[model samples]
Target: MVWKLPLHESGHPENELTAESDGAVIRRTVLPGGVRVVSEQLPGQRSASIGAWVNVGSRDEQSGHFGSTHFLEHLLFKGTKRRSAMDIAEAFDAVGGEANAVTGKENTCYYARVLDTDLPMAVDVISDMITSATIDPAELETERGVILEELAMNDDDPGDVVHEQFSAAVLKGHDLGRPIGGTPDTINAVPREAVWEHYQEHYQPETLVFTAAGNIDHDVLCADISQALKVGGWDLTPGVAPRARRDTTPIVGLGQESVEMTIHRSVEQANVIIGSTGITATDDRRFQLSVLTAILGGGMSSRMFQEIRERRGLAYSTYCFGSSHVGTGTFGLYAGCTPARIDEVTELMVGELEKMADSGITPAELERTIGQLSGSLVLGLEDSGSRMNRLGRAELVTGELYSVDESLKRIREVTAQEVQVLAQELASRPRSIVRVGPFGS
Candidate 1:
């Protein structure tokens, strides 16, 4: 069983709680100014991973500000009031640690992995970056060119471009459909003021989650974070409720019709994705859907790999994936094959989908997929970085926390019938196809 620490809301300067189960101790401390710090101490681990999770992403941007979130992600690393980009780099390098950040559809995370003894420095540096970024106009202009190069790079990859088209086709007219990196035009047009305004509005103490995992003391780390933020003039007031969760329900008005889009590129290989709308992140069927996806195309032993690569040698790569957001999701089967074989590949992929929907997976497939899913889940959490990510995402995104054992048990409890039901439900949805290849092939 997973035990969650009881939270204290008594307006204390540093209200703390701890929960222990399965040999893992999870701790939480509500600091002044409504900052929430959560940590998990892993025994005998020499490294610590920490992340400052901000509850904003591309989906939160308005129409004209398409790439503001991602652009800001880059700008934050450019310089802070206390440290230049070079200083920040040297700080991490001195500790033999790595620092990075990522912007997703719904959140942005700035994280670092460092020796356990350097946990304090990691917290200080990351907190400083978040709370004190200069967002200099000169820096913004430089980063703008960098981001345009990034967009150009994406344009050069047919596989990446096809997935973008697939998203636009299926989730048309919604912010979720737009690329996380704004288009070149939008990126160029967005004024520096707009991004700064976004940063100010979203980067609040209450909207951030600070999480660390490894051999560390939660109380000391919390104090370090508080001190760091205080250096940037953050008001550490206690007793305020954290910001309410953002509503992530995308505006969906496109009719549920099968949409097919083709992007004519000069690439030698055709990249294709056959996909459909899927359940939300909060849906109960997600576990079963995961199992279903695994059996269909998760590994060399998966059905798609065996049928497409092993038997026919039609493609070197083929797989199925499911992506869930706060209120919407997608399931897709992707293949990269010679343009000459695009039609055959699509036919076979779609046929497999129809078969799974109608007949369901066999008992052996179900057991094997469950085992694969279980093993993958266990193996993924073996490091402090993974554990830190799990903690931050759970606190910021899902709002539900579970221990490793608890998560594995849930995956193990998925029944064959449940997977079959989910498979049929997902397969029955109208599929949208996007292909990128030479025009006449």
Candidate 2:
């Protein structure tokens, strides 16, 4: 935000992964209970965001309790030892701030964004919910109806329905392949203790991180976070696998629901999911894969949108993204196009990847892609929420905080030769695909 914002925070290993423009002071501290803290100072902004990201998500669900993580997320909003769900909402609403939480494949995060004056209060309310969450049976039953409604909502959307099926198909057996939200039946069947025990096991200090970004005094943050971390009286258990990780058959997890909504009355838009075996959060070559994603589908001027939309007008939208967890990652491409163009679209998406694998990207494409990515990185920090996510996710995956300059350096170092080697090896490698359309599949 100022001239000092340009200097990168040095000495943190994870910074190389997330920061883009080094404009803040990044600090890391380890507290009792194995909890990690990442605090970043963003000068000249009035808003701040604090996020508590736990290192477990839907994939961590045990059999018969398939959607435990997501279910648990809902129950947290019901109430906690220190506050009712409504009371929690009112506190933030009184100040016009926002509070929310989400469950993902490898982690669960609860965050609040508020004016800098409210950071301390925001921290307490959020910390209370995560460490002191109490799930009442009556509340879980009520939440069941809410979850079922969510499932119904997903069923009504063709795109969501197919992606859910894709997750089911891809991980066939791995937690990574499962939906973050469990099935209605599984959600109903889970007992209170099962969900409670999960928190005990997964929400350990070592596996959790408290992150804050924007408009806060650094010394105050250190003290406030230290106090927030101290409020939770629960003892964290060590050495337990957060949840049993299961392996499933590798397959193209595809599903179809045709004719239910009057097949011919609707224009045909097939949803496609192409994914492959994972990479690690700490992998050095991740930037290469990121560059490949941009060149292929990042913008209207990029490869997919340019060739598919600008040049030939073969489809409406196409894009590719690569994601990595602590132990696994995926490079996936998604597209929506008319049924008549499905085969051609799929072919083009796969073909470009193959071409890039065989013949590396041109020098111009590499330069543009690298530059675009660097710019995007710097822009993301403008939002306190984005900055918090950057820090929270960084602590979860690599256990370090980075300065923005450190992150941009890594992107700048991504080379055409590096991307080609990585892309070629990955594209040639097997990928599980899922498609939902009118043509028998």
Candidate 3:
């Protein structure tokens, strides 16, 4: 018997069986011009979720194109050459389906959920938006205001503001540090020509990945994508392969050390985020870090939760969070507490990190964290939308798909020693501290 590795995104054959386990069958098909289609079929599922992932994101924005990637995501659904915005909305509503788009640091996804029979329609509508958006000047102006309002809404939340500030401070000079939606200045300055140029340059067949799960036929889905894309004026030239996975080499001079800043907001509670540079998305130590994060502040029983909330009643919410990108990541702890308790909470948070760095999780803590992560990993994929998201991310970011059991195995294999080492490394890194509250100027 021979052991074979899973198929990767860059150079797999035209069609392949990517993974099969228990009752789910996952497959992949590469179309002309590097368009990739991946799908998973759950035998008994009646609902299907589909996602069209474009390889462009905020980090890909050029000098004048800041926020254009996310702005383009909004523009796509505004209207396409073949359908009006209202028509697009009604198409999904009439079928009782849900559709939306998400623009992240590294990619954008337009996704929908509907009955299995409506999968083709979902694909057609989303593909049309992706390929043939008119980017009408009037509609662009309208969406600009909407996005500005959206940004304003986010600014109103101290927690969101704090986290955004933390990223900007930590990643300081990096493109990844910029907000996904762009700042008000950039959004207002980004002319229509810049956005259209961005659209024409990045939204090519080689830069798109299509994925779906739940009652899907891989070949049929690929065909549907092909037909819809061709109708929308895409050139599906043969022999092209999908773009390679994101390079994981750490971007040079991208992180700042020991930076701290405070913003005054007229809020009763202070929101604080203390974080530092962490692991990349492809780093094998992500599993260990996952365990480490969970034990530190993942849930109610987590150390941060128990100590900060249950023991002292200092804060109503406390948690540790992390974000992993191609070659860099951010790890931090967040707590919202009364303004008077800000210093005390910050001290405790730093103290807890030092403790973990010095000593390590106990055997019991390790066991509980493994179980917690395993359960969440499996439970999060219980729906078709989650499954579709998993496929799209695997194909877009990591380039390889791991089965649920394989993912669980990796999580369970994380050792206490590994987690401690990761913690120590994280603690040693210079930290970035951000606070948002009504502390006197």
TM-score of model 3 (CA atoms): 0.97
> lDDT, candidate 3, residue 61?
96
What clash count does candidate 1 reach? Answer: 2
How much is 372 displaced in model 3, in angstroms? Answer: 0.9
Deviating ranges (above 4 Å) for candidate 3: 1-15
Q: Give the Å shift of residue 366 in candidate 1.
A: 1.3
Candidate number with the higher TM-score (1 or 2): 1
The full ranking of all candidates by lDDT, starting with the best, is: 3, 1, 2
Best by TM-score: 3
Model 1, residue 224: what's the lDDT?
Answer: 93
lDDT of 3 by residue, 345-396 (tens): 9889888888999988899999988889988988888898999898887877
- Residue 354 deviation, candidate 1, in Å? 1.4
Q: Please give each candidate's TM-score.
A: 0.95, 0.85, 0.97
How far is each candidate from the true structure, as Cα RMSD in Å? 2.1, 6.2, 2.0
Model 1, which residues run further than 4 Å from truth? 2-17, 248-255
lDDT by residue (tens digit), candidate 1, 1-441: 544433344255334657774576888877777778889998888999999999898889986677899998999889998899899999999989999999998899999999999988989889998899999999999999999999999999998998888888887777778899989999999998899989999898877789888898887998899999999778777776566665556536542888999889998899999988887776777788888888888899988989999999999999998888887888899999999999899989888877888888898998888889888888888888888888877776666678777788899899887887888888888989999999653
